[model samples]
Target: MGLFTRLDRASVLYNGMADRLGVGETQRIDQPAGAAAYRSALLRCSACAEAEACAGWQMEHARADAAPGYCRNRGALAALRVE
Candidate 1:
């Protein structure tokens, strides 16, 4: 409802989505560009309108090869996967 609350929810969704997709920050965040992308994803998520849908999607997908179509960072997060 509040700014911090929304951001917190976004963070949860973002991390949850990444977890399901088998992506982790430790392998990429060491680079400056990757770090920037990480922050960008969080901010983009914080501003997203599909946060509720994303949470529900994560609940259904414990392990996935890709993010849901509606995910704002779908391509970006996909690129993070090692292969």
Candidate 2:
């Protein structure tokens, strides 16, 4: 994919996964530390080898207690879920 396309896809996947785990909006992670984690999560998702699997997992789970094991942003997202 081109740069914009890749970023868009990653943003969608990142947000979708967050929603599944009740993490609300990515933009809402505005505490200095949270903002950093949010940025890292997007970057990680953009380069993730498991993007395809993540998309499938999001499709299968409308809402979930946690992120899939393969998700690179699992811990960051879980933190967001708690806050």
Report the backbone clash tally of model 1.
0
Give the clash total for candidate 2.
0
Residue pairs that clash (backbone atoms under 3 angstroms), model 1? none
Tens digit per residue, CA lDDT, model 1, 22-82: 8875744754577677778888899988988898888888899999888898988887787
Worst 10 residues of 1 by lDDT: 25-34
Global Cα lDDT for candidate 1? 0.83
- Candidate 2: Cα lDDT at 10: 92
lDDT of 1 at 74: 91
